[model samples]
Target: MPFQGRVVDIAVDEVDLGAAGVVRREYTNHPGSVIVVALDDDGNVLLLRQYRHPVGAFLWELPAGLLDIDGEDPHIAAARELAEEADVRAARWDVLVDLLPSPGGSNEATRVFLARDLTPVPEPERHTREAEEADMVAVPVPLEEAAALALAGHLHNGPTVSGILAAVIGRANSWRTLRPVTSPWEYRRN
Candidate 1:
């Protein structure tokens, strides 16, 4: 079935669940995505303010990009997004969180990475900013402050809020809970 309001294919499937009989699941087919919490040596996180039309206002978010490039590793995608969107490179990267953004509706899986050891790159090497990103602004917010704002209902972006909270708690736990950048991403395996 074709549902053509977006670039990706959207379809409905009838799935059997044993004694549960069959149910229809309608969802948007999506390639996975990656979010980068570019953490600076000063304990600040890179924040991007970009206009999200659906949200009706500019919202705060971390550097992130879709993992749509065929055959690109998630880590490599994250690295590219960091450089392209923020004009920075990270020497250290670790998986902060793996997400199923809307389990009931879509198979969109996202991985959030904690990026450290930042170094600025030359403008020529950056991705040409287009659309919303052309007027977007990047700001460095202290981690704790970002967490505080998130808790206070100011930071509303889902991935950004989740990433900030995870980073704060992960730090308190000595980041023992974070997985390696190369760790298996189950959803992506499909």
Candidate 2:
């Protein structure tokens, strides 16, 4: 069987699809791209609280954007978004996870990255059409606390929460491989 879909309508930001044997038309959106869940040296997760016009509410989310073009790699876009949104640059980067914001209707994919050894960079001039004049604070929360907040539904942003979870688990697994050190009392015992 071949999977086929037809575009019923096209717009600047979204498209409606009518697939074979499907009852309702599915909405496919070009959300561009995003990068989220960056960590600083102190094991703190960074987040941004910004207002979204579509939702008519201020939402806390990880830094992310749609791809400027089709051929652009998601990793590069992630790095750029991290710098732009948070004004921080990372010396090390790893892809923690890739997420589909809404699998049922939209094609929006969010790439979460674990960034370390961060250094402050000058803020880039805003190019977005939306007004972003409010102070954008880079609040650092402890990894464990952040995870708890996410679990309790206080942190509603999916990508941001997922990124933090991935980083915490990855760091724990990495630490498990290290050799244990002898205590000072052990030397006296010998």
Candidate 3:
């Protein structure tokens, strides 16, 4: 490891490509993560407006979290993020999409789940927010509007845009493209 941080590690390695000969490469090793595209009955996607220090701006994004807890299922992680970030729980869950956001530079595999059958978490049971999340604002935007914003470059967060577009495609297909929540996650080493 060239450098190790709390959430990620930067690694430098030597690689051999038969045709190109040996080469050096550097990349980030991530713990993987799960994203929840929670949809209400009205077809509005739950989004959170939170400050991103790196960007120095608040961006709307789906409920998501890293799979940091050892042995925790991705499905459970998705559910936990939905509840913690959106104060809601979803009874219906399906795999919408899986992606490597930056394959060339990072091993950050993310699984986006389609969540429906929503119910609010009682106030007494809600998770207490902290840091940037403490000031996050939850907003529900219609699928079409979200897609438009994403296409317009207004929603710049990578996973948020991906999840929104995937939801749009899934909806168009009557959600037939969605896989079972327990579907195998090929990108995840765990």
- In order of appearance, the predictions have TM-scores of 0.94, 0.72, 0.97
lDDT of 2 by residue, 58-96 (tens): 777767766654566666677777777777778876667
Model 2, TM vs. native? 0.72
Tens digits of per-residue lDDT for model 1, 1-190:
5776543568799999999999988997778789999999999999999898987998889999888788899999999998988999999999999888887887889899999999998877877899999976679999999999999999998888989999999999998988998898888734
Instruction: Tell me the lDDT of candidate 2.
Output: 0.64
Among all windows of 10 consecutive residues in model 1, the one with the lowest summed lDDT is 1-10
- Backbone clash count, each prediction separately: 0, 7, 0
Candidate structures ordered by TM-score, highest first? 3, 1, 2
Please provide, for model 3 over 1-190, each residue's C-alpha lDDT reduced to its tens digit, 9 standing for 90 to 100: 9799999999898999999999999999999999989999999999899888988898889999998999998999999999999999999999999999999999899999999999999999999999999977679999999999999999998999999999999999999999997888888867
Regions of model 2 farther than 4 Å from truth: 1-24, 123-130, 175-190
Best prediction by lDDT: 3
